[model samples]
Target: INIIMDTLAGLAFAGEAALSRYMLEKPIPKDEQLISEDMWASILINGSVAALASLFFLNYAPIRELFSRGMPIESEKAEAIFLTAFFGFFVFMHAFNTFNARTQGLNLFEHILENKLFLGIIFLIFTVQTTFIYIGGDVLRTVPLEPMEWLYMVMFALVLIPVDLVRKWVRNVWFGNPVQTRVNQ
Candidate 1:
């Protein structure tokens, strides 16, 4: 089941890559000139390289142990499946996110800075909360693992998956209409 899911995720990533390429090759209006072949190529190459480096780094004992977190033995097959799905989703997410920002008329630098700040704050909050919970008391004993975490994660991902739809909606309602907002200089 996990392998099948992982394969599906990989296929999805491949589809996203193809879609990005297609978007790059198409003509973009002056107001929506964000998707470019150079940008897509850079993203694709860098993402693939990062994934490869992560896979190689995971072989190191320290890195492996860090991820293991003193947990008991799990199936190696499951680990591979998890890793595959992780990378696949990561690639697709990055592609979709950049595509969304481009289609939104957001400058790359500003968009990245904003997103990094948001992610950093979320990471800090989660880290501090988890640390305090562990230090202050054994909350893990009282709170059993719930499927809600998985559900929330899935929902979070699904929200991003509609980037193209949102772009189309925005264009149709806001920009794609006959009304031009520019002033003649």
Candidate 2:
């Protein structure tokens, strides 16, 4: 399952890379070039989606039950920890990926809007997953999760975005030519 999922994610990333290249081929006006605001917007949008998914679905009983169903593990705490770690890592990974993909090595913001279709697909996938885990509890052999668990998941998942943003800022200050060039004039 991990292999399959990783393959699918790799494919999705390849698609995003193709889209980014295609978009970059277009001629963009100087005034419409990437700005700091656009970078912030991209970070906020992607980060918020990841945080929400972690908060709402990570420790949800249904998802936990789904994992616990085949295992001989009897402790709910163990299940919760496993699921939290698994989903939390996923949420952070995707959020970081979003930041990397949006920047696309140029540290530009235009790529973010250029790949709206990809972002929408991500949103759709999350929605479908949430629905499946929530509504298919009986068939999936999962249980609903408590609100507190959701909170914990969210808090853990929320750290990645700010860290990435700071990294971007540092890059901008030391290695970024775009922002500095614009400011020098």
Candidate 3:
């Protein structure tokens, strides 16, 4: 599963087109660090936010009951709703990382729609992952989740975007703005 996810990620990241911001930024020197401090800020902050949110969904009661399907909750059932939510978001957070990884800076949505391949790959990831929850049954250890469960999960994972935006804003506040040479200005 991890391999599959990484492959999808590679495809999504590679397909992103050059954005206008690319024109404004100065080129990196040959000896510069591969990952900048800003990138690390985003990596730590957004990744922590997503992981914490997934753990929250795992413990949230309403979600547990919603996915439980009348199975006795305290009985340590294998297909419990809370567990289901965890698995869904496990796949979802990885699926959604495409958005977080899309940008060198914070404006992830800039020129977003211009890349049809990225959009399609994301669609494939989400659609297939959800479908697996329904059809995977014993192999996937998933109980069928209602559509509302899915909506809640997707919206829940969507919080990564706002969390990242705030992370970027805070980065600018403490570390100063990104050094973009305003070339062709």
lDDT, candidates in the order shown: 0.39, 0.52, 0.72
lDDT of 2 by residue, 1-185 (tens): 24323543454455454443444454557898575654664568656765676565554666454445355435865564445445434644563455454442445354555666556655554554445434545564434444555454445555555655666666566767443444354
Better of 1 and 2 by lDDT: 2
- Pairs with steric clashes in candidate 1: none
Which 10 consecutive residues of model 2 have the lowest summed lDDT? 1-10
Summarize candidate 3's per-residue lDDT along 59-115 as a digit string, tens digits: 777767765657766655634555666777777877776787776567777678888
Best by lDDT: 3
- Highest TM-score: which candidate? 3
Error of 1 at 11 (Å): 17
Identify the runs in model 3 with alpha carbons over 4 angstroms from their true place: 60-62, 69-71, 75-78, 104-107, 173-176, 179-185
**What order do candidates take by lDDT, descending?**
3, 2, 1
TM-score of each: 0.28, 0.46, 0.82
